[model samples]
Target: MANTTVPEVFATETPEATVEIDAGAGKHVEPMLWGLAPYQWVSISMLVLLLFAFFGAKVHKTIAGGLDGKIAAIKQQLDEAKQLRAEAEALRKEYADKIAGAEKDAEAMLENAQHEADAILEKAEADSKAMVERRKRMAEDKIAAAEREAVEDVRNRAALAATSASRKLIGEKHDAEADKALADKVIAGI
Candidate 1:
């Protein structure tokens, strides 16, 4: 009996089916790998290196821009500080000048006051001297008047005594007409 199961052989073959293509097939396409291998891995590593290089250059440029900006900001602050210092110095000078001017004004005022005081004192002294001189002249004039009055009184008394002596000697009434005539004759002769 022919081995009823016809001798079977082990095989590992895949049957192929023909696919129809039309003239209008849009485009031929490159096949994609569904799995990774050593060659593909090398290619992936080169791509990754190129990407990292590009991104690293971009990061460096960004960092440089930020550093430049920071430097500019610091320089601006320094300039501002310098300007402020100059302004402060100018203000200080102005204040000093004002203080000096005030001091000079005060000194001038003091000098003017001193001059006024001196003038006042001089006037007072002159007034006092003038008053003293006026008082002395008045006193001298009063003394002269009083002396003249005393001399007149003494002369009158002497004349009365002489007239009485003449009356006693003559033993007569001294008439007014005779006395007048005698006084006039004596005065004219002297």
Candidate 2:
């Protein structure tokens, strides 16, 4: 029979001492404190800091008050914007009504102008007709007067010719015998 001895795999002299084992790779160990891992300790530290800030500094109250002030200011601005929008809408409606009224006034003016133009045209036509009629009457009167004057002149000339012819006949044919015979005839008739 051969004699052999076995080596202790795990041995520690203190509770705080870290254990090491040889694997095929290099040593890899995570540090610890109070039975917690490093990551756990960091998380606990962050939580304590938050608690201290909330209780000792009243940080939550200050944050809440600041947020409330900001919200109130935003609400006031919103209300002012709403009031301005309402005023703008009212102004737009007023202008629209004015434009409608202006359109109506323009239409009325056009109608009146058209009526006046028509009336003027009618008056002008009547005046022209009256003027033509008056001119025609005057021309007719002038023609009638000219005709009467010509007739009177012809009659006067005819009377003069007849008197001259009668005088010539009396001078040529009338002698002492004609004179005596006319006197005897006239005395017998009387």
Candidate 3:
């Protein structure tokens, strides 16, 4: 009964009497309902329902907590992945910039080498021209010296031949008295 307690019903019972319910006791006895009285059935059903509710709430709380923790972990991992991706992109950009700078430097160095080669070639050409001019002047000077020596030799030979012919003519044509007079005159002029 709603208003009765289990202890009161057992306290009023006779030890030698069979258990019986009065019509006014508000206790319904189902005939052999799985060997359980109606009150027992109600009590068992309520107890089962209560147990189910208590365990179900605990299980739900546990499942929800686990799901929340997993979600937090997943979010953290996603954030870390994003950060790593950003760093990788920055590193890639930095390397690209360095490569671009190196390429530019290489181009500049190549141009400088070409200019230096051109300058060296020009200097060599100028030096060769100067050497050629110096050689030409030396050859001309040698030729002039040989010409002067030849002219002096020819003049000396001509003067010697003229002296010899004059001596032979004077010896053949002049007498001893004329030769003596001429010698005296040549000595006076000398």
Candidate 4:
């Protein structure tokens, strides 16, 4: 026999039914199925469906597990956020209580200062009143002393004037005629 080319041998080995064209309007591809009997085609389709069902169940299980993990993580994060919020609220309450205490202390201090100021004002008023009264007593005593001194001076001057007038009257009043008349009366009476 004559030596055959590679293309001729290949075309003769695979029959036209086993190598059908799968040409389309916009695609060019070789046939995927050989020229098989009806029973052989049915058997191959059933085997491919069984394989798809097995692998589909495995893919479903994997996707469900991943979704469950994501949900658990979200729940844990929400719990942590709640805890943080609780801590913040506690801190706010603590600070508010401290501020209230400080305000109370400040109010007490202000009240104490007001009482002290009132006491100081009252003391000062009492001291000033006492000083005024003492000054008044001193002025009255000085006036009384001056009046006594003036009365004593007036009495001494009056006594000196009366003694001078009596001495002058006695010197001017005795004489000779009064002596003769007084001798006659004196002889008769003896």
Candidate 5:
């Protein structure tokens, strides 16, 4: 065996001197258990745990079943949502139809009311015209009656004046002799 000194360089501002000895060079040994290295044993242990979970615990089946259940729940929820949407659409259509019907009914009612109003107006106009005609006729009849009454009064007054004048003339012209001669003539003629 021989000892040798070697100079080593460091990243810092320092140099180191190391002693080299030939002691089992190029031959290495690592600690192992069951003919496996530490890292290999760790890998084997992880594989064993996975196998145990798969077979003994049935963890994969449980996980898959849980995921399947969640999927089924989601599908059910989607179906319910679709049903609700369909119902909503039906209700909306029904309401829309009802609104349309209501609008039509309102239009009909409005038209009917307009017709009635027009009829009433026409009737009122006719009634007013008839009333005016009747009043005019009545006034004409009254005027005719008044004229007839005035003519009758005038005729009666004239007749009374003529009778009085004739009586006065007879009394003034026929004296006692003329009255006796008129009487004798009327007796001889008879």
Candidate 6:
């Protein structure tokens, strides 16, 4: 087969060679370093510049829009805070009203309790006074009855003594009918 080489297909080949004949040149031989060519670097830089030009406007716009979005978010939060403050104020007012109502209710309850207590006390005092009056009337009636009984006893003792003395002096026995008549007359006169 014929010898094949890649140089046969190249349109152009530029090879650079350097030869050192002197012995005093550097003791170590430096190998050839491979790197990007000047033209490749320039082309890459040009491509990067084109890419930046093409998409830079959009990126700048996106960044500006993102900043505006952040500002809008902060404004929304501020509005929410204002709304929350208003709600809190409303709640506070409502709570204050409830507290006032509760206080009024408590005061009314206390007044009612005081009135009830006064009524009960008045009733108890009235009952006690009535009981005392009733007891005094009963005691007075009992005393009058006792005095009547004592007077009756005294009259009965005097009549008995008079009858006994008469019976002894006269030496006579009285019939039941006569004695009853006399006793009746004496009792009636007394």
Q: Please tell me which predicted candidate would have the highest lDDT against the true structure.
A: 2
User: Over the full model, what C-alpha lDDT does candidate 6 score relative to the true structure?
Assistant: 0.83
- Which candidate would rank higher by lDDT, 3 or 4? 3
Q: Any idea what lDDT model 4 has? A: 0.77
RMSD of each: 12.9, 10.5, 11.6, 14.0, 9.6, 12.3
Query: Which stretches of candidate 3 lie above 4 Å from their native place?
Result: 1-46, 134-190
Candidate scoring better on TM-score of 1 and 2: 2
Regions of candidate 1 where Cα sits further than 4 Å from its true position? 1-49, 131-190
- Compare the candidates by TM-score and give the number of the best one: 6
Give the residue spans of candidate 4 off by over 4 A: 1-15, 18-48, 123-190
Model 3 clash pairs are none
C-alpha positional error of residue 1 in candidate 1 after TM-score superposition, expressed in Å:
63
Tens digits of lDDT, candidate 5, 24-143: 665333455545566889999999988997785677788889999999999999999999999999999999999999999999999999999999999999999999999999999899
Candidate achieving higher TM-score, 2 or 4: 2
lDDT tens digits by residue: candidate 2, 1-190: 6667786555223446444546769875455555676678889999998889768567778888899999999999999999999999999999999999999999999999999999999999999999999999989989989888889888888889988999899989999899999999999999
Which digits, one per residue and each the tens of the lDDT, describe model 1 over residues 1-190?
A: 7557766743233222222335585632222334443467789999999998999899899999999999999999999999999999999999999999999999999999999999999999999999999999999999999999999989998999998888786557666788899899999999
TM-scores for the candidates: 0.45, 0.47, 0.50, 0.43, 0.51, 0.57
Residues 58-145, candidate 4: write the lDDT tens digits: 8888888988999999999999999999999999999999999999999999999999999998998998898888888788778877
* Whole-model lDDT per candidate: 0.82, 0.86, 0.84, 0.77, 0.83, 0.83
Candidate order by TM-score, decreasing, is 6, 5, 3, 2, 1, 4
- Specify the poorest-scoring 10-residue window by lDDT in model 1: 11-20
Error of 6 at 93 (Å): 0.9
Ranking by lDDT: 2, 3, 5, 6, 1, 4
Give the higher-TM-score candidate: 3 or 6.
Answer: 6
